[model samples]
Target: MNKEGLYRDLSTVKQQIGLAKQFLESLNSVKFDRKNVLSWFKKLCGYLTDIILTILEIRSILENHVLNKKTMLLYLYQINTTLSLYINTFVAECEIGEALNEVRIFTTKKLSSCLDGIEDVLIKGISTYPENVGNFILWMDTALEKMSEIDHLKEKEKCLKAFSDAKILFEEVLSHAMSIAQVSMSEDYKIIRGSSQSVLEGLESLSNEISKENPNSAMVKLFAETCSNKLCALERKVNVAVLKICLSTFAKYTDDLENIHKFCFNTENKSKPRDLDNLVMEFDLHVDRIMQIGLFAISCSTNMATCIKIRSCLASLEALESELVPAFNAVLLDYCKQNCNLASILKNHWLNEAVLLKRLICEIIDPLAFCQIVHEENKYLVHTLSLDVKANKSKIDRSVTEQVIRNSIVLDDFLKLITYEEDNIIHIKENISFLQKIIREVKAASDVFLPQEQPELNFKVYKRCKILLNGIYSLCKNFLVENSENSFSKEESLGNEQPVVTGNGFLDHIINRGKQILQDRSILYRSNKIEAFDLRSTTLSKMNALKEKNKSIPLSKLVHLRKISFVQSPTRNQISCELQITDIVNELRNMSLTFEKC
Candidate 1:
C-alpha cells in the first residue's frame, strides 16, 4: 500500500482509539444494577473490540516501509499503554452485580488476554522497524521500569478507599451514639460512650497502620472487620437506648392521659358548661403534651408513615384548636340567639360533637397508653384512626354539612345583630369579632378538608367587612379622643361617634392616630400633578414626536427614557430690562466706533 493509504488507515486507527477512550471514560460513570448490567458488559466488549481493531490496523500499517516507522510506532505505542491503563483502572474500581458473576468472570478473562495480545503484537512489530530498533527497545524498557510504580500507586489507592469507607462507618456510629448520649447520659449510656471512644481510638490506630510503607492486607482486613463489628455494636446500643427512653416517656404520659380520660369522660358528675370548659382546657393542655411526646417519638421513629401521620394528626389538632373551636363557639352564640338558651345550645350542638372528637383523640392516645407494646404491633394507632374516621365519615360529614348549612342562617343573624345594634359600638365590635371567627373557621375548614372544592370568600364581602370594622374603630377613636366636651361635634355627629372612654394615654394616642389617618382628606388630592403623567404616556409622546420629525424612522430606533423626565427652570427671567453697567458701557463703545468708521 502507498504512504497516503497507510496514513489514511493510521488516521482511522487514531479515531477508533479516541472512541475507545471515550467509551472507557463512560465506563467510569456506569452504575451497575440488574437492569443495566448486561448493557454495561456490552459496552465493555465494544471498547475491547475497538482496541483490538485499532491495534490490528496499526500493525498492518507498520508493515509498509513508506511511512516513517519509528515515529508512527511511538504514537501507536501510546494508544496501547494509555488505553490499557484506563481500562485496568476502571475494571479495578468497578463493582459488578453478583448475579452476573459468571458472565463477568468469563468476559474479564477474555478482555485481559486480548489486551495482553494487543500489547505483545505492537511491541513485537516495533522491534522489526528499521534495522536498529533502539527507540522501541528503550520505550519497552521504560514501560517495564514504571510497572512497579503503577502497582504501588494502585495499592495505595485501594488502601485509601478502604480507610475512607471505614471512616464513614465510624462517623455514622459516633453520631448515633452521641444522639443517644444526648437523650440520656445515665450509667448505662456512659458504657455506650466508653465503647464508642474505644472504637474511635481503634479507628485512629488502623488509619496509622494503613499509612505504613508495606501494610499487611490481612491485618488491615481483620482490623476493618473488627471496626465494622464495633460500629454495629454501637448502633445496636444506640437503638436500644432510644427505645428505652421512648418507652419510659410514653409510660409516664400514659398515666396522665388515663387520668385525663377519667376526669373528662368517665366522671361521676353530670357534664355541665363549667365542666365542659374545664374539659376543653384540659384537652388542650394534654394535646400539647401528646404533641411534645409524639415529636420525640417521631424523631426516633424509623417508619416514614408513622412520622408523617403523627405530624399530620398534631397539625390537624392544632388547626382544630385555633380554627374550629372558635367557629364552634360562634355557632353556639348564634344558636343561643335563636333558642335563647345557652344550656340547650351546649347540650344539643356541643355535647355530642365534643364527645365524638374526644373519641377520636382517645384513639391516638389509647395506643400510646400501651407503652409496653412493640412499635410494629402498636403501629395500628394511625391505621385504626383512619379506619374509624372512614367508618364515621358519614357522621362527620353530616356534622360538617350541618355547620355549612348554618352559614345563611348565621349570616342572617349577623345582619340583624349589626342592623339592630349598629349604633352600639360594643355590640358592633362583638358582632364583627363573631363574624371574623365564622369566616376564619370556614376558611380554615376549607383549607384542611377540601381546598379545591370549597369556594373562597368573595372579595367584596371581605372588603365590606374590613370597611365596617374600620368605621367602628374610627367612631370609637373620634368619640374617645377628638370630640370636645367629649360631646358630638359636626364631624363627630356626622360620623355618629359612640361614647368611648379610653383611660390609657397610649391607647388614646394610637386611636387618635388611627382616626386621623382614616379621616385624612389629603389622600383625595394628588401631591404632585406632574407625577400623574406616568412613564408610559411620556415615552409614547416622545416616540410620536420622533416619528413625526422623521417618518422613515422606526419606533424601536428612538431613544428610550428609563424614567419620566420633569423639566424645571427659573420661574422669573434672569435677564434684566434695565441694562447692567458693563452692558451699557459696551453698547456706547460700539456706537462711537461705528459713527467714527462712517
Candidate 2:
C-alpha cells in the first residue's frame, strides 16, 4: 500500500473504532429504556471493531515489510490481541451486570409474575451455563497466553502468578456454583462437554508453553492423559475422592492435618477456621480429581498401582498404639465437642465422625514429635524406589516439599502447646528438662548424617533442618528463662502466647558462637568427661551421691554444668567443620616428638 492509500485506510479504521467505542459505552449503561436499542447497537459495534482492527493490522504489516515485516507483524498481532481481550471483557462485564440488574429489578419491583425464575435464569444465562463458562475460559486462556509472552522477566513472572491465581479462583467459583445447583439445568452430558472443551483448550495452550520450558514433550504427553478435561463437571465425585485421599493415606493425612492445625492455630484472622474449612473442601476436591484421573488412566495402570504400593509401606507399630490412642482421642473429643452443631443430617454424622477423627489424626501425627515419623511416612524413600518401577517418575515437586515442612512444623508447635503445662505455676516446666536432651541428640544425629553421600541433600538441607531444630530449642529455653519465677497461669496457648526463638537474648550467645565456628575462630572443646558408667547413676549408691552433690552447687555452676552436658560428653577431639583432620594428626605427631623444652 502506498502512503496516501495507507493514510486513508488508517483514518477510516480510526473513525470506525471511535464509533465502536461509543456504541460499547452505550451498552455499558444499557437499561430497560435503552436495552433493546443498545442490544443491536452492540452487535454492530463488535462487527465493525473486528473488521477495522483486522484491516489496520494488515495495512501495517504490508507497509513495514522491508525494515519491520516480522517486528510489525508481531506488534500488530499484539494490538489485535489486546483489542480482542477488551471486547471479551466488555461483553462479560456488561452481560453479567445486565443480569444482576434484572434480578434486582424483579426482586424489589414486587413483580409477582413468574419473578422467582428470573434470578435462576440470570445465573444460568451469565455464569453457570456451560456455554458462558466455556467462552469465559477461552477468553481467559488466550489473554493469559498473550500476557505470558511479555518481554520483561518480572512482568512475565507477575502475569504467570496472576494467571495461576485466576485459574484457582475461577475453579473455586465454578465448583461452588456446581455444588449449589439443586438439579443440573443443563444435562450432565452437556456440562461435561462444556468443561471438557474449556479444559482441553486451556490445557493445550498451557501444555505447549510448559513444554517449551520443560523440554520433555513425550513425558508431558504421558501425564496429559491423567489431567481429565471433564473435571469441573465432576465436582461432587471429585470432592468425595479428595476426602478419601486426605483421610486414606499417611502423606495426605499428615499434610491435611498440618494444614488444618495451622488453620486453627496460626491465623491472625478470627475467621481462619472458616477459611480453612473452605480450603479443606477445595483440597479434598483436588484429591478426588487427581485420584479420578490417575487411578483410571487406561495405559498407565502401573503408575497408580505403584503409588498405592508406595503408600502401603507406612510403618505400623503395636506398642506405640498404647500411648498414641489417648492423646489422639483427647484432641478429637475436644474438636468434636466444639463442632456439634449440625448443618445437614448426613453431614451431621460425618461431622461427628470428623469430631472422632480428631483421635486418628492426632495419634497418626504424634510420632512426628519423636523423629520417628520421617521413617514412618517416608515419601522420599518411596520416590527413590519408584525410580526402579517407572524409571521416569520424578521426585515430588519442590512446592510439595515446602508445603509439607511448613505444615509439619506448625503441627509440631501445636503439639508442643498441648504437651506444655503452662499453668502448673511451680512445676510448669516439667517438659523443660527434656529440651537439652533433645537438642543434644539432634545435634549428634545431624553430625552423623552430614557426611553421608547416600541421601544426596548435602549441599544445605541438613543445615537448614539443624537450624529449625535449634530454633525450637531456643524457643523452649526462652520460655523457661522468661517465666523463670512466673508461670503460664495467666495465659492462653493461642494468640501469640510465647516468643519465637530469636526473641531471647541468651540464644544470641549460641548464634554468635555458631557464627564464630563457621568463620574458624574457635573450636568447641569437650567440657565434660564420659565416666565409665559410674556417674551415669547406674546403681543406688551413685544416685545417692549425685543427689547429695546436686544440693550444694551455685546457680552459675549449675547452668554451666547443664550446658556442658550437650558438649559431646567425653569426646576429646575438637568439634569444628573447618578444622582439618590432617592438621590434628600432624599436631599429635609433633606433640609426641616434642623434645628439649628451651
Candidate 3:
C-alpha cells in the first residue's frame, strides 16, 4: 500500500478502536447481563484482531518509510496509552478491578516493552524486533481472553458494570502530536525564525538611522526593503500545517511594511505620526497574532530547542516593534521629524517600555506548565464527570437538573470573570466565595439521591465537587496573595482543605489499577524505581509531595486573553480536503468490512 492507503488504514483502525471504547463505556447504560458483557468482549476482541491484521499488512510498507515509521511508532504508543486508560476505566466501571490486577500488570509490561522497541526505533533509527510486535499481540489477545472470563464471572454474580453511554469522540490527538514531528521535519520554522530575526534587526537599524538628524535615504530604503523581503520569505515558507494558520497575517505584515516604506520614501508627503502610529499598531497586531499562533503551536510540543528558538525570535520581533513604534512616530511627526534630541528622548522611553513588555511576557504562563497543569486538570474533570455519571444510576429530578445547569452557567461566568478581571482582587474573591457556595449547594442536592453512607467517597460526584470547589478556593487565594497588600495566614492563604485520598474498596481498586499502569509506564520513562504498593498511602503521599512542590513552583500559568481567543476557523478548501479524506477512509473501511465478510 502507498502512504495514502496506509494513512487510511490507520484512520480506520483508530475509528474501530474508538468504537470499541464507546461500546465498553456504554456498559452502564445498557443492562449488564451475560449477553451484554459477552457482546462488549467480542466487539473489543474483533476490533483488536482487525487492528492487528492492519498492523501486519502495514509492517512491510512502514519499514520502507523510516520517518513515517517513527511517527507510526509514536502513534502506536499513544494508542497503547489510550487502551491502558480505557481498560482501567472498564475495570473500574465493572467493579472487577481485583480480577484485572494481574491483567493490568501484564498488559502494562507488554505495552512498556513495545514502548522500548518504539524508543529504540526513535533513538537508533532501527525497526523494532518482529518478536516485540508478535509478543505484544500474543499477550494482548490472551489479556482480552482473560478479561472476557472475568466479565463472564462478574455477570454470573449479577454485578452490573457501571459504564455509561458517551458520545463517540473523534481522537484528533494524533494530528496534534504529528504537527510537532511534521513541523520539525519540514524545518520551515528555521526559515521563518531566520527571516523574522533579520526583519527585526533591519527594522532596528532603519529606526536608528531614521533617528539621525540627517538620515541616509538610501540606507533607510535599503533597511526597509530588506525587512520586506525577509517577511516575504517568511510568508513563502507557510505551507506547513502549524505555519499555515499564520499565512494571511504574515502576508499582510509584509504588505504593511512595504506600504510604510512607500509612504516614507516613495510618496511626496509623509503621513502624520498619529496616522503612522495607527499603521504601526496594525502591523504590531499582525506580529502579535503570528507570535500567538507560534506560542499555541509550541505550547504542547516536546521539541524544547525548537520552542526556545521560536519564542526567542518572537520576543526579539516584539521588542523591535516596541522600539519601532516611537521611532516611526518620531520619524513621521513634522515637529520632531528632524529633531535628533526628541528622537533620543523617545528612544529611551521605547527602551524602558520594551523591557516592561518582555517582563509581561514572562508573567504569561510557562507553555510547558500550561500543558501539564491546565490540560491535565481538564482531562481529570472529564474523567471525573464520566465516572460520576457511570457510578450514579439514580436519576436527578428536573428541578435539580435545572438548578445545576443554572449554577453551571453562573460558575462559567464567574470563571470568566476571574480570568478577565484577574487584577480585581475584590471581584475575584467575591466570585470565588459564590463559586464555593454554589458547589456546596450542588453537592448537597446531589447527595439527596446518591448513597452517602459509603464514606469512601464512592459517589464520585461529591469528590469531584469537593475537588472543584477546593481548586477554585486555592486559585482565588493564590490570586489574592499574589495581588493583595495584606498578608494572609498560612491556613487561610492555602484556601479550603484539600480532599484526602482515603482508603476505600471501590476507590482503592480504581486508583490501584490506574496507578499500576502509570507506575509501569513511569518506570520505563524515568530513572526512579518508584512503586505503588499501598494505594491509599502512596496516593496521599504523592499528592502532598506534589502540593508542596507546587507551592514553590506555579502549577498553572496565566494565559493571555488573545491567545485563547484566537481560533483558526477552517477555510472552504480545508473543509473540502477534510471531507475528501474522510470519504477515502470510509471507502477503505468499507472494503475492509467486505473482506471481513468474505
- Give all TM-scores, in the order shown: 0.24, 0.19, 0.20
Poorly placed runs, candidate 3 (over 4 Å): 1-244, 265-274, 334-598
On the 0 to 100 scale, the lDDT of residue 180 in model 2 is 20
Worst 10 residues of 1 by lDDT: 557-566
Q: Candidate 1 on 201-266: residue-level lDDT in tens? A: 657766776788987766666665566455545444544444344333333333433333334333
Please give the RMSD to the true structure for each candidate, in Å.
42.9, 35.8, 31.2
Best by lDDT: 3
Of the candidates numbered 1 and 2, which has the greater lDDT value?
Answer: 1
List the candidate 1 regions with Cα displacement exceeding 4 Å: 1-154, 254-304, 313-598
**TM-score of model number 3:** 0.20
lDDT of 3 by residue, 1-598 (tens): 7878867865665565555545444444543233444455445446555654555554665555544354444334333333433343333435431222322333334334444444344334454212111011122222222222222222322211100000000001111122222233234434333333443455456456555666565665565455444433332232222333332342243556545544443233464545665666666555544544555444422332333333433433443443445544444544332333333333343344333323333333222222222222333343455454556534423333333334343333324422334466566566556656656665564565344433233344445554554544454344433443433232321111122233334333333433343223211223223433353343334335434655332111122111221222223112222232234334444433443332
Give the alpha carbon lDDT tens digit for every residue of 1-598 in model 2: 6877755665555455455545444443545333453354346435444533445344443332321222222222222322322233233335444322322221122211112222222222211111111122222232233223222223435535533433443343233223222112223323422343344355446445543543343433333332322232233222222222332232343454345444443335343445655655644433333222222211111122122221111111111112222322223344432121111111222223333333323322222222222222223333443343243322323333343344334334434443332454334243333434443443454354434533443323333434444444334333344434322221111111111122423323323422332222100111113222231122224224434755331121111001121223334222221132223233333322331110
Per TM-score, the best of the predicted structures is 1
Candidates' C-alpha lDDT: 0.36, 0.31, 0.38
- Model 2 is weakest, by summed lDDT over 10 consecutive residues, at 310-319
Q: How many backbone clashes does candidate 1 have?
A: 0
Which pairs, if any, clash in model 3? 28-163
